[model samples]
Target: MFKTTVTPRFGDIDGLKHANNIAIAIWFEQARNPVFRLFTPDLDLSYENWKLIMARTEYDYVGEMFYGHDVEIISYISRIGNSSFVVTQEAWQNGTKGAIGRSTIVHYDFLNKKSEPIPDDIRKKLEEHLQNEDNSCK
Candidate 1:
């Protein structure tokens, strides 16, 4: 499991002073940094070297989050497939779970425009952050 923090800005709030729904997505994306680094160590952006693409994303809001404080995001790879892995994340504020999300990221071959098999080395690293059956981040 990996944990990161995001401090919502003024623009991230809605009329009710709660962090906007879209802002939650941004924070979840930010929390996926480790998985990205595992796939592209040097942060290479070149097409040939870029290794992953988001195939799908979904989130469920569990509680409202206010803007005065930061939110803590917990991220982990809950499942691993041949060409993709599922990143499961949760955002918590003031000890409450604000939202839960999952993303299907595929190992992609940009030059050939197809999904590629996730390399064995990268898969092993992903297992390091695997989520447990109870859904606790660890």
Candidate 2:
């Protein structure tokens, strides 16, 4: 699991005095980067030879979170396929669950127009971080 501490900013709050939905999505991206980097560091960081695009994202707000609240973002790889993977996360504040988030990222071959399998080297790196001791997914 990867965990990050983020300080909610005033701008993150909306009229409801809670963190805006869009901002929370951005936070999810920030917290998930390490997992991606573990597979490929020094990536083009663009729509190039390697990068995962956000195919889908979902967030559930269970409790209110506002400015002045230090939030914890936790991420784990739930599944890995040949060309894509799923990451699950949750945001917590003051020991209470604030939100749950999940994202499916697809490895794309920008030069082509379809999904591309993850490279062997990168796959090895990811297997090292799998939550299961058996690494059966590999």
Candidate 3:
């Protein structure tokens, strides 16, 4: 699994003084930089070079997140398919799980405008961080 830390900013706080739901979503996406690097080593955004696209995303809030605390974001591949993979992530703050999320990313050919199968080399790398049924990397 890949882990990242996010420091909540004051602007992220809601009227209730808790981190806003939107902030969690942004944090989750930002924490995915490592995974994005797997497909684009240089983090290039050129249409021709970018090979992955976000197909879906969902999040469930389990607890409140307060500002001035660090949130640990853990991410791992939960499922791998021919043309797509699911990334499962968790947000933990103060030893409590604040949120859980899943993102489906598809490998696609921009020129062809169609989804493509993931390359073997990349697949092997992703397998290295694959999460097992018990929520541990294999």
Compose the digit string of candidate 3's lDDT tens values, residues 1-138. 899999999999999999899999999999999999999999999989999999999999988899998999999999999999999989999889888999999999999999999999999999998986356322
For each of the candidates, give the backbone clash count.
0, 0, 0
List lDDT for all candidates, in order. 0.89, 0.78, 0.91
Query: Which candidate number maximizes lDDT?
Result: 3
Tens-digit lDDT string for candidate 1 (28-59):
99899878999888878997888899999999
* Global fold similarity of model 1 (TM-score): 0.95
Better of 1 and 2 by lDDT: 1
Candidate 1 wrong stretches, greater than 4 Å: none
Q: Residue 138 of model 2: what lDDT?
A: 13
Q: Which stretches of candidate 2 lie over 4 Å from their true place?
A: 131-138
Preferred candidate (lDDT higher): 2 or 3: 3
- lDDT at residue 45 of model 1 (Cα atoms): 90
1 or 2: which has the higher TM-score?
A: 1
